[model samples]
Target: MPVVTVASLKGIYPPIATPFADDGTLDDNKMISNIKRWSSATRLSGIVCQGSNGEYVLLSTDERVHQVKIVREHMPAQWQLIVGTEAGSTAATIDMTKRVAAVGADAALVLTPSCYKSRMSDEAIISHYTSIADASPIPVILYNMPANTGVDLSVAAICHLARHKNIIGLKDSSGNVVKMATVRKKTDKNEFSLLAGSAGFLLPALSIGAVGGVCALANIAPQLCCDIQEAFDTGDFHTAMAHQHRAVEINTAVTSQFGVPGLKYAMDMLGLHGGPCRAPLVRLTDDEKRKLDAILRDSQVQHTERIHDR
Candidate 1:
């Protein structure tokens, strides 16, 4: 009954951060608050939960399903909700995907299986995705974040899967501009799309022909991300470049230099409720905080003034 069409899944969608309580538990209160904030903040085509930035690797299967349900229950009706359904094993991933789809997630994002990285040749990886895609109740978005997953979904593998009627698009977090370009150029452009996985690569990906992005950086600066895409669409390259640079600097700090704590701090500073990250992941040190603050200030993304309010 749910629509699995490609048109509905294309655009800037942030795999949003899961805000936790000070005690490091899943803060439903803060999570719901972020959902409300994002729905009104930017031109987000949709919302993605439990992806790498959301700490999907750390959560239990039950926790992932619950988060998906809560996000779906609270998110705006017009926005498509995509859940990160990747698991350590194919059977487990497929099982989790079914539960999430039933809870109203419009799509399931499955990253390449990584535990057996050496053994996973292109053939094995294809078997994994094809089997899950064949059984998933909802549409599938292949997530290619090599930094975290180690296993890269090469352009050829992506092109091969694009022919499947239910595999919609790819979120390439590999940070390799050429890989994104390759997927964009070689895939069935009509049936599939390339979503820049990292905000740092959004402009480069777009210049080479990507449809949109699913950025961790969007967790902090949503409007700028939207504006970059808008600028390109409307023939405003200068503004797009300006926004693109700002996004790159901010993403570098929050995602690469500072990681989760820096992101949570920036989110809190920007009026979004980015509470503590879960256990095992500590907050930023004082020196790190000072540097992160400086980065945000330089990029003009840390001020109380909302880019949207302007």
Candidate 2:
């Protein structure tokens, strides 16, 4: 795989949700449809398969690679496909990174090995990233999702990783603006792309110096997410703030508050195929669905009908 330029990492890229059949099998057709719809509907930087939103943790290694391959085959040529290939061990992470790269992912989003969270010292974290970046065939983007992985890559550790030629960027989901600012100040803007991991704080992240975002909200509202960045780029802070404000409730609803199932349900309501979440991850309850409907309405998201219609 070729190295992904920092330019390719800019703008809004949705960590797309994985569609599964009622029987718990990957629904290739639904996945393809969702990708096609997203590509045509908005100007996204690209699609991220097998990321946190895609339920990467729940997938087997082969399934992860296969999902990326399928997405790559169907996605627009201009769009860069980034695949999450994190594993418990450096060797395993490297191996999976190679496999995904072979299947056509433009870059790899490697999460910290958090099963041994207590032992992941700053030195251990730096060593882990350096080793993977050194060996990964594709450019590596560090993933910091402390909520899920229980491992937060500190600003110092991130800056250290940014110096590596192969470690190109970071997806900071910590929602810590001060930390993001510190990392931005330390790294070279030309070499290390800083991406907000969630839409909740994308506007603030960009205000500080983040180049773009890998937002879950982009899955249901790509245009809105992109509009926020577009507005900021054009010196339209007023418009950007409005969009950012609207995104907050929905972003929280679909992400930190509701999780993937909520996002899938939102997609379904909006006329996209957001089928069942894989087992062990249940569908939104009727009560939760009602609340999600209200959030979507308040956020002005397009759903099956008006909230009043319900």
Candidate 3:
């Protein structure tokens, strides 16, 4: 395992989807195999386990911890391991945070508690994160995923949490880059960091000071995601824009258009293990799978061209 440090977090990370056997059992062998492949691929700062893409809400606490354990054991010793540990209640969140830290997580990505959405005011939001950050053994990264959680972290609340020493950064999945830029302007850059939650806007986010991203698209195209960051960092905006535009359709397919099952299918197409999602989250239909196949084939053609250009 790598030594956990906030400074080492400035690059791309794939919020990997969990792999389940056909009968719906956890596939440990597949999980280990995927992490090893991802670590050796191209340029990833780390891996995020049990994120929304990982189906964390559907998993048992023990299973979630097991996911982190497998990742820690197989991932490169130089790669950081970030684990998602959000729960419905504050006490549950704090308890899970400690459990993952005991295993090997460099940081915990805590989503806003939205079970009581009406009551999750700015004050309540601040109090929730404050309690967790105060108790967590590792640093905390606030996760603002409005699409899934319904509770979005206000800039005021995020800026307030930035004052806490234990809270290190945020993964804003809202796709509102303007708000993200506003948060960047308001918060202390050294004490706090910002991460794009999706690859759709990753290039734009980095342009406005986001450190990197935790893209679901990276599961199938890790090197593609790295190319976008590398192009931007080296001041090649024209190439970066081209890469971002070409990625949008495929990124949309695996994200809002099809969700996790679509992303898993994409992974399987690339010779990785993405067997099936758990119950309640079904697999794609035969027709939908074909559509995804067509999308991939087309994307690959464009991606190959970019590789040559670079």
Candidate 4:
């Protein structure tokens, strides 16, 4: 049985970066420290351990499970814990989902299987999510990351899956507000939660009824991200727009432009344990680091300590 049941998925949740040591092994100490720091720094709704920002595709099955266990053990009970359990096959996805559920994750964020993109039709996509959700011990949140997965879950298919008893919500990273609004209109507002997968257009999505965001920007600037949602929730659109504009620049830098390496570097700059990305995802160049530093400074992301010796 799943240990946590996420009744409401409204608020900011950071798709946390996986910290690796210089030797390329998981740095448990650093990861725990990062979790501790994030918990204290902001009031996030939850923490996503193996989402895209976490470099989920790079980790082995066992490593993914271990990451969730570590996060579950340390995270505050008030915060929901969601783990990315996406796999290439439905059977594999279900297995991973169950594994994470056993370790205490409240829900599984399963990405669309795009290994055979040509065959991932509407019927195929619906079946994939339906089967996984049917078997998952915990509720499943559909992950639509067309940038990485290549296959986008159409609004029609999403509306269909929204009816599933076990499938609860979506994390749409496509940045298509039109499609998001359409899906929002077609689904049951009470039963389905729509989460923007990027902070780039979080306020717009929220304006169109998105519950919150699961953003890479939140990894370094969690309070800022949360503030956007908080301000909007309280009808302060002016304040939310101000935060949203700043978030777009920073979000683009860490996500679409520089990817995981840039995000880890940004985390390091903010005095968290960002360490290194796994193999193949190299460290940022000096020029890239300088650019990222300027962006963070400009965005006013708080840092308890300086990136360099002060």
Residue 113 accuracy (lDDT) in model 2: 91
Q: Per-residue lDDT for 186 in model 4?
A: 95
Best by lDDT: 2
Pairs with backbone N, CA or C atoms under 3 Å apart (clashes), candidate 4: none
| Per-model TM against the reference | 0.96, 0.96, 0.96, 0.95
Model 1 residue runs over 4 Å out of place are: 1-4, 304-310
lDDT of model 1 at position 63: 84
Q: lDDT per prediction?
A: 0.83, 0.89, 0.88, 0.88
* Candidate 3: Cα lDDT at 73: 84
Better of 1 and 2 by lDDT: 2
Error of 2 at 159 (Å): 1.1
**10 residues in a row with least lDDT, candidate 2:** 301-310
* Candidate 2: Cα lDDT at 159: 88
Candidate 2 lDDT at 177 equals: 88
The window of 10 residues in a row where model 3 has the poorest summed lDDT is 301-310
Candidate 1 to native Cα RMSD, angstroms: 1.6
Candidate 4: how many backbone clashes? 0
